[model samples]
Target: MDWPFSRRGLFQGAAVATGLAMASRGTAAPFDRLRQKNHPGWVIGHLTGAQAVAETLLAEGTGCVFGIPGAQENELWDELKARNVHYQLVTHEYSAACMADGYARATGTTGVLCVVPGPGVTNALTGLGEALLDSIPVVAIVGDVGNGEKARPFQVHSLNQVDLLKPVCKAVYSVCDVKQIPNAIRQAFQAATCGEPGPTAVVIPYNLLIEMADFRCPPLAEAGVPFDDAAFAQAVALLGDKRLRVGVYAGLGCMDFSGSLTAVAELLQAPVATSVSGKGAISDCHPLGVGWGYGPHASEVAEIAFAREKLHPHKSGIDVLLAVGVKFSEVSTGYYGNPRPKHVIHVDVNANNLGKAMPADVCVHADVGLFLGKLLTCGDTLRRPTDGHLLAKIRQAKADHEAKLKAIPAAKCGVDPLALVAALRRGLPEDAMLFTDVTASEHLAAESFRVTQPRTYFNPVDNQSMGWSIPAALGAQQAACGRTVAAMIGDGCFLMSAMELSTAAREGLPVKVFVLDDHAYHYMQMLQKAAYKRTTATELGRIDYRAFAQAVGVAYQEILVQDHLDAGIRSAVCHTGPVLVRVLTDYGDRKIRWIEAVRDRYAKELTPAQKARFASRIGYRTLSLKPEKSD
Candidate 1:
C-alpha cells in the first residue's frame, strides 16, 4: 500500500493521519490524558470552544449535562452530541439547575447544567442558591452576549449573568477567549467541589464557543480537605476531656465520612443528631443516632437525648456539643433554639462559618473526614466505655417518637399528613432516593421518616426553595441505576413545578411523584393562625389531579384514605414509567413541632412594645371576628 504513493505523498498522508489522531484524543481514557505535572503542551489538535467544554467535562468524569438549549449555545449542544456527552433537556432552566443538583446529590459528583443568559440565569438562581446553602456541588455553563471584535450594543438575552450567579455560586468564571474555555470549565468544577462544596458557574460568551484554539489545558489536581493543626489540637482538648459528656452534631460535610462519624460517636458514647441537609449521614436505626436538630425545635428524640441532667437522672445531658461540619443556621437552630452547652467545639472546612451561628468555645478549621479520622487515631485516650444506660434512654425516646407518629388519628377530612410520611417510609425501598419539598411535612419527614444511607435523602433545607423535589427526583432518576427516585411534593409547591412531570414522561424517567394535596399552603396557615388568630393568602386552588396527570402523560394514582396509602405508594413505585400519586391530605389538628418551637423562640426575642402590638392585634381579631372561622 505504501509503495503506491511517492515519498512526499507518503509523508503528507502520515501528517494527516497524525492530525486526525490528535483531534480524536478528546475521549481519551484517564491514563492517556495529559498531566499538568508532565508539562504536555499542545499535543492535541485545535478545537472549537464547544469541543473544549465537552472534552474537559469528559476528562473530569462528569457523566451528564442538564439544561435546555437556546440561541446562544446551539453550537455547544452540537459538540456535546458529537462527543456523545450525555445531556438532558429539562422543561425549564430552573429544573436544569435543580436536576444538576439532584444528580450531584445522588451520584456524589460534580453535576453540570448549560443555559443561555438573562432569564435563563435568573430562572436558575433559586436552584443554585439551594445548592449553595445546602452545600451540594453543581457546575453551570452559561452563555453570554458577544464580546471582543464581535461586541454589539444590543444583544438578545443579555444581562449581568456573572453578577447574578456570584451570590449563589462559590466561584463564577467568565471566559473571554476560546483558549480559556477548557481551563475555566475545569476550574469551575474544582470550585464547585473544593472546600465547602457549592454551585460554580462558567460564563462563556456565545461568540467564543465557535472560535478555534489549541487546547492544551490538562485536568488539575482535585483539592484535598483543608486542616488546621493548632485548631484541631484545641478541639481535641475539649473533646478528649472525660468529665465532659459529648454529643455529635453532623452536617452535609460529613456525608462522605459517615462510617468515620459513626465510629467517633460510638467511641465517645455520644448521641448523634444531624442538620436538615445531613439527614442520612448516620443511619436512623443506629442506637446512638438521634434525628435532625438536637434542639427544642427539632426532633423530640434529639431534644430529649440532649436534655440536661434534670430530664434524665440515669445520664447527664450533653455537656459538650461536638458540632462537626454543621452550622447552627437560623432555620436549623429554630432561631438559635439549640441550648448552649457547657462547652462547644465547632469544626468546619470554612473558617468564616465557625462561631457565627452559636458561640463556639473552641472553633476548629478542619475537614470533617480528616477531623473524624484524627479522633479515631488518638487511640484509647479518646475512647469512652459504652454507656448502656444512655443507649436505653435513646431507645426509649426513639420508641416514644414512633409511638407518637402511630398514635396520630387518621384525619377525618381526607388523608392524614402524618400517615402520608409513614406510608412512604414503609413502602419505599431501602435505597430509594427521597426528595422532599418545602412544606410543613418537610419538618415531619425530618422527624418521622428514617434515613439509613448518605445521599439517599434530600430537601431544599436552607434556602427553603419551593417545588424543588419534582425536577430533582427526575434528575436523580437519570443518574440512578435502577434505584427508586421519588418526590413528596406539597400541594402548594406542586403548582410551582408540577409541569416538570411532563419532562419525566418525555424522557421516560420513572420518577414517583407523590403530591400532598391539602388544597392550601397549610404551612403558612399554621404560622398566621398562631400569630394573628386567623389566616390570609394561604389557601391554594385545587387541580383535578387525575386529569392533570393524564394531560402530563404520566400514570396516575390516588390515595383517598388510609386504605389507599400503602397500595398507592406501591403501585406508583412499581410503575415502569413516571407516576403522579395524589394523596388527599388533611393536616387537621396535627402539630408541627418545629414551627411551635420556632414561634416560641421568636416571641421570646421580641421587645415589650413589639409584644404588646402583637397581643393587641390578636385581641382585636378575636373580638371583632365573626362566630365562624374566616379565611
Candidate 2:
C-alpha cells in the first residue's frame, strides 16, 4: 500500500478527477467543480490540531490573543505566528487572562488566551474568576500533557487542569483526539459568549496538538436565547404606574444594550444610576445618567434621597426600581442597607440571577438588549415624566459632590489625591480607556473622574484585586489599537504586576501607567486608622519608580506638585510606547475621616434593624462613636 498521502494532495487530486469527468459533459467549469468539492463545511487541508484551533479563532474574527509561550503550548504559538495571529506575550499567565478579560470588556467580543497546563492553568485562575464574576466572554485554550500521560506521576507540569479550572470556568473541555480540536474550540467560544457570558477553558493534550489531521471548521452556533414574553408584559404593566417614581439601575450586563437602556430611560424620563462595574454603560454626561455614586462605600439611599430632594423634593423615595442586568450585589446595594423598592422590575439574561439578592415583582428572563428593544416598542404609549426638575437636581448633585471634593484641605505629605484626579481628568482624552486599582485612588476616581463613554473605565469592582489595572489596561489598549489607555494604580498594586511593563514595551503597546505613590496601602491604612485608631504593616517604603521604569525600558516621570501633574500626564499619554508617571500622593487622614463621616451620615438614615443588618453584612466591629479630629 502507498504511504498515507497528505490530505491536501488527496483533496486536490479528487477535485481535479471529478472536474475532468464533469467537463466532458460541459456541465460546469473545472474551477467550479473544485470550489464545490472544497465547500466551507468540507475538509480543505491537513493541519496539526494546533493549526486547526488557530484557524477556528481566525474564522471567529478574533483579532488578538493574550498568552505566554510554554513547552506544551509552543506548537500553538508557532502556528499562531505562522498564521500572523496577534499574540500578546504577557509576563505572567495571570496577566494573560486579565488582558483577555480586558479585551473582551472593551470590544464586546470573546477574548482568547492560550497557556500550558499545571502551574500555567493555576496561575490564570484569578483572572478567570474575575471574568466569571464580571460576566466577561473569554475563551482560554490550555495545553496539557499527552492524553495517556496525564495520569503518569513523573510527567512534568502535569496535573488535573480541568478540575482546577471547573469552579472558575463556565465550562471546561479536554481534547483527547486531534479531530476534536475545532469543535471543542467552537463550543468553547459559544459557551463563553452565550447568555450571561463568562470564561471557558479548552484543554488540548500535548500529543494531539502536534498530531496532523484533516481539519474542517465547524459552523458557528446560534447564541441567542428567547425571552419570556409573559414576564415582559407584566414588567411593562408594573412599570406603567405613573404614580411610581422610577429609577433605572444598570450594571455590566447592560453594556451591550446600553443604547436601548438609554432610549428607554429617555422615554420614561427616569434618572439612571450605574453600579461601579457598569460605569460606562451609559455616558455619564447623558441628561439622565447619575454616575457611579451608589456602591457599598457610596451611600445609596442617601444618594437617592439627595437626587429626589434635588429633583423632586415633593416625591417620596423611589417607588419603582427598574434593575437591568444588575445582580443587586452587596456593594451596589450598600451592604443591603438601602431598602428595596416597593415594586422591582428586574431584567437579566440569566434566570438564576433574577431576585437572588432582592425580590423582583416582575422578572423578565431575556437578553438586556432584546428586552430593552421590546420595551421601546411601547415607548409611544408610555408617559414621559417631567424631567426639568430632575435634570436640575442631577446637575446640582454633581456640583455639590465636586464642591465637597474641592473643600478637602491640601495635603501636607505629597500631592493631594483629589488634585491628582483633577489633573488626570483634565489631561487624559475624554475617550481614553482608564483602569483603576483598589486603593485611595479608586475612591478618588470614583468620586471625581467622569467617564463620558461606554467601556472606558475598568475597575476590579467585586474582585477588588490589586494588580488588575496595569495588565488590564494593556489588554484594553491592544483591543482599542490606537486609542489612548491608562491605568491609575496605587503603589502596592504597581508592585504586584509592574513586570508587565516589559511585556507592554515589547508589544509596542502605548499604555500610560500612572503610579499613585502614597508610600502605603492607603485604603487599608484608612480602614485600620478608623477601626483600630492606628495602622500597622501597611507602609511600603518608596521605590524609585523612575529607575524601575528605566530598568524595564519604559519612559518615566515623577510629579510632586499640582503644576507638573497635567504636563506629566500629557507626556505619558502622548508617548509613542509604554510610559510610567508616578505621582507622589499624600497619605492624608482626610480620606479616612471622609469614610467615617459618610458612614455616619448613612447610619442616621437607617433603621435599627437595617443598621444591624448592615453591620452583620460587612462583618466588621461597630465603629467608635468618637469622631477623630480632621487633619
Candidate 3:
C-alpha cells in the first residue's frame, strides 16, 4: 500500500539512477560491478528479526535506545548489545518511553525503545501520550506473544498490543511475518519523524524475534508535505503591513529554523515571545526576544514584560501576530484569555492545526524551517522601521521584570522557590539542558531561567505529567553526551520516578537532580487553598533524600536555608556523577500570592463580564473583585 509522503520512489532510483549518471566518468566500473545480478550487497543475508531491526535503526543513525529488557524481548537486548548499540536500561517501562521522548526532544531525532506486551505496553502509554501531546518523535518496539499463540487464555504478557497503542501512537504496526521486519521498521521511523511528528509503535511477536530471515532492506525516504505558496504570499503581505506592529509567537515547530525565525523578527523589528514548549527556540537574551509568554498562565515576569513591551494586542499596541509552529492550545493560549491579533498569520506543518484553536487571517500549511527560510529571503524588501524606541522600551521592561521577580519576598518558613531557581540558573553553565516537572518551581524557572540555545529546556507543558523530569533528563543527558543536564522537580514528582535514580547510577550518566522538597503537591495545594480554603491528599510527607540517595548509590546534598543555596547548587553542578540535591522549600504561598496579584492587576483591563468569566474559568472567584475596588 502507498503511504503519504513515502520515499520508496527515491530509494528505488538512488542506486541505479546515480550509477547511470556516473557512467560517463571513469568511476563507473565500481557502479557497473555493483549492478551485477550476483552482487553480494543484493544477496539475502541470514539475520534474526531482532538483528534486522537493530541494523535498520543503525542505518537510520540511532545512537541509543532507552528501554527495559523483558522475558519476551531478551533476544532484542542481546542483539543490541552484540551490535554495540547503547541501551539505556530503565527501571520502569514508562520511564523507558519518557527517556526516549526526552532524547528525541533534545536531539531532534527519532528515539527508539523496546518493551514486552501487556503491562509493558500499558505502562508506556503515559510516556507515549506525552510524546503525542508534545509532538515529539519516538518509536516504541513492543514484543507480543508468538503468532500461533493467538488468544490463549493464560498466556503471560499476552494481549492485543496494537489496539492498546493505537490511541496514543501516530501509527501502530504488528509484524506477523519475519520478512516484513525491514519494511515495518522503516515505516515506524517514517511515521514517527514525519509531519506532526509523534510516537509510533511496532509490535513483533517474541518468536519472530528469534527466527532467522533473509531480510531485504528497502531504501528509506525523507518525509515532508508541500505547502501552499498562495498562503505563503498572503502571509507575507499581512506581515509587510507597516501599519501593524508585528509580534512573533514561536512554538516547538520553529525550533529547526530558529536562525531564520529570529531573522524574520529582526527584519520586521518585532519582539519574539515563545510558548513554554518553545522556550530556547531563540536565545532568551537576544534583543528581539521579549522572553516567553503567549498565555495568561505564563511566568509572572514574562507576563509583566509582555504587557510592558506592548506585545499583548488587547493590552495596547501590537496589531498583527505571526504565530509559527504554535498549537494555540489551552496552555499556550491560557484558555483563550490571551487576545488574538487583529491580523494573524498562522503557520504549521499540520493543516488541521492552522485554525483549530484561534482563527487565522492567513493559514500556511508548511514546514516551519522551509517557510521561515522563504520568509527571510523576502524579508529585506519588507523591512520595517526597526523601531529603536520600541526596542529600548522592551529592554527596559525586561530589566524591570527581572528586578521585580528578584524582589519577591522570601517565605517566612523555608527557602524561597524563586531564590532556589535563581541559584540554579547561576550555578549551571549557559548551555546546560534543563528539564522541569509540573510544580511551583517550574513556574519560577519559567520566569527566572534564561535558555540561550534551542533544545536546552524541556517541560511537560501540555501533558503536565509528574515524574517526567528525572527520566527525561537522563535521556537528554545521554543524547547530549558530555553536556551537563539537570532536572528541577518537586518532591512529589521526584518520588513518582525515584527508582530511575538507580538507572542513572548504573549507566554512569551525570545528571544533576534538584528536588524542591516542599512536602506537598505545591501547585495543586495552592489551587486547593485558592478555591476551597483547604488542602488534601496532595501533601506528601517529607522524604530523607540523603538516605534515599545513599541507598540508590548516588551523591546527595541538602540545603535548608538561603545562604548555602549557591554553594550547594555549584557542588551538584560540578559533580562528575549523578547527584541529588534536595532543597527544603516553603509552601510557595508567597509566589502563589504574587501570581494572584499579577492576575488581579491585569484583570482590571477586562470588562466586568469578561472579568467574571475569566475568574470563573481560572477558579479565582475568591480573589475576584468589583472593577472599581483596590487591593
Top candidate, metric lDDT: 1
Candidate with the larger lDDT of 1 and 2: 1
Q: What is the lDDT of candidate 2?
A: 0.78
lDDT of 2 by residue, 247-338 (tens): 88888888777788889988877878877788878877787787764433552322643244444445535778888888877545545544
Candidate 3, residue 494: Cα displacement in angstroms equals: 1.0
Query: Of models 1 and 3, which has the larger lDDT?
Result: 1
TM-score of 1: 0.93
Give the worst 10-residue stretch by lDDT in candidate 1.
36-45
| Cα lDDT computed for each candidate against the true fold | 0.87, 0.78, 0.80
Q: List clashing residue pairs in candidate 3.
A: none
Cα miss at 608, model 3 (Å)?
14
State in Å the error of residue 439, model 1: 0.6
Candidate 2 segments whose C-alpha is farther than 4 A from its true place: 1-44, 149-152, 293-296, 299-316, 404-408, 592-631
**Clash count for each candidate, listed in order shown:** 0, 0, 0
> Which whole-number lDDT from 0 to 100 does residue 230 have in model 1?
89
lDDT (Cα, tens digit) per residue for candidate 1, span 1-631: 3467689988999999987875665344354454433544222346778878887787778788999888899989988998889998888899999999999999889889999998999999999999999889999999998899759887887788898999999999999788988788878888888888999999999988877766567567768778889888887777788888999899888999999999999999999999988888899999999999988788889988888767554476888999999988878887788888888999999888999988988889988888999999985778899888889889999998888767768789788888889889999998999999989999888888999999999988889889999988888898996899999989899988889999899999999999889888988899988898878888777699999999989999888987788888988888899999889888888888899999998898999999999999888887884752645
Structural similarity to truth (TM-score) of each candidate: 0.93, 0.87, 0.86
